[model samples]
Target: MRLSEYQVRFRTRDLLAISGPDDFILGEGRAVDSSRMFEPDVSPYCFDLANRSLVCVSTADISGATFFYQAQRQYARTVIKVPFESLPDGPASPALIFSIGRCGSTLLVRTLEAAGMRAVSEPDFYRQAACHRPLDISL
Candidate 1:
């Protein structure tokens, strides 16, 4: 489909949730409104850096016990693409959590959510970024 067909108005929060450059693009995406982008079910799947656009996908309500990546692959239907420049500026810094394998990271995230805090589990973009980063960097 044509890129123009997927154009939509992106709110500041939506843009913030999709922050950072995407490592790759997911073809021509589907268009959705701002509210859809606000739901946890809808995620920023990737970016079309060449076109300066952000791609988002719908995976239904994933706030329960569903695995994030599994939900994306299984239920993803609608996708949206918006101009990167149209996104408003967000906070200068972001809160992040890091941990090693089997370190209760998931439990901690759930705990934070239970406490009424917003926390994103494993997001695919982070994995993509890690894969695309230069391997020659010195520690």
Candidate 2:
């Protein structure tokens, strides 16, 4: 759902508990809610491997036309930290798209989405992984 469609209120402690350890937590998170962590719109915005934690923020409605970083910062109030070990095992095989700059990759992704395929455009997690060379986790 689009972030604007719903009021983004800070969840209450009881609600957080009911949402489960993998869904919500009080204050800064020590572990990520695995379900929300994997959503298409949730981007792993920061990583602190030494601390074994990463921060995720929602990016709903972000598209090729949007300024990614600017929009992310505005929508970052819901950010939460997740420990490395809390991350679930990835799919045995995952599909990916790669292209050089100005190659219409974004257009291709948009087209695919129009055809009912789920795709994320230049996700921050991918960029983070690329910049943070020699990552312990396999890409």
Candidate 3:
């Protein structure tokens, strides 16, 4: 099938580029609009970095849009496509990993990210954490 002129032109750059509807859009009312607008949308863009074309479609209503890798149009990679439906009713908090100063915590987190895990590196821990860094670890 053929694509519309707009689709050919403003198919969107990428989710990383879009960040959110707060950024500029390229269409109109009942379409990509003004107003730092954020809404449900179906955007298709090619991912040069991942070396795969992708499609992303979602909204804050049912859920926010997500990048469906052309390789796997079923789930998201970097971030959740939609906000969590609900907090777990049970008391099963996630495990925590605390690293000491300059202990290669970022390297560990980067490795996890490369393995497709949602990870973050917090260098401001010294001022952020309430407890003192433990002095030792077995391994």
Candidate 4:
């Protein structure tokens, strides 16, 4: 989806497109659901937003649009999303992150967590910074 269109869609629907370790999309594929996999796709509810149709290219093709999903849908990338409460203490290694933008940054933090590394994201870096009170006291 085009960034502009995505903006509208995001607002319209409470949906998030995540891509690695605990990827909702990765687990959103037909294969994940044994029953669904057994049953052939009869609805053919594919999302074909290509050919000047506000297409946003990913590694995989998202041919259909749906209201709800049970399986993890495979996408162009991988995402490992852990709830904030589940995330570990901060100080995520800068080197461990390959973040340059919004999505990349989120995936990076998850990657670090999956790798059993202690890290925090740029957004949460302040938490780490704020954790330490000044050694020198001032009025």
Count of clashing residue pairs in every prediction: 1, 1, 1, 22
Candidate 3 residue pairs that clash: 59-63
Worst lDDT run of 10 residues, candidate 2, spans 15-24
Q: Write the per-residue lDDT of candidate 3 for residues 28-94, one digit (tens) a residue.
A: 2223222111223433222211221122333222122222222112222211121112111434786
What TM-score do all the candidates reach, one by one? Answer: 0.63, 0.61, 0.27, 0.20
| Model 3 residue 131 distance off true place after TM-score fit, in angstroms | 7.6
Model 4 regions more than 4 Å off: 1-98, 124-139
Model 2 scores what on Cα lDDT? 0.54
Candidate 2 per-residue lDDT, tens place, 48-136, comes to 55566666666566655333544554454566556677777778998988877688877887898899987666555556555665555
Summarize candidate 1's per-residue lDDT along 25-132 as a digit string, tens digits: 345544445455556656766555556676666666665543454444445555566676555476899787777758787898799989999766766566555554
Candidate achieving higher TM-score, 1 or 4: 1
CA-lDDT, candidates in order: 0.55, 0.54, 0.31, 0.28
RMSD of each: 8.8, 10.0, 16.2, 17.5
- Candidate 1, after superposition: displacement of residue 19 in Å? 16
- Kindly give the stretch of ten consecutive residues in candidate 1 with the minimal lDDT sum: 1-10
Superior candidate under lDDT, 2 versus 3: 2
Candidate 3 lowest-lDDT run of ten: 78-87
Better of 2 and 4 by TM-score: 2
Best by TM-score: 1
Model 1 Cα shift for residue 23 (angstroms): 13
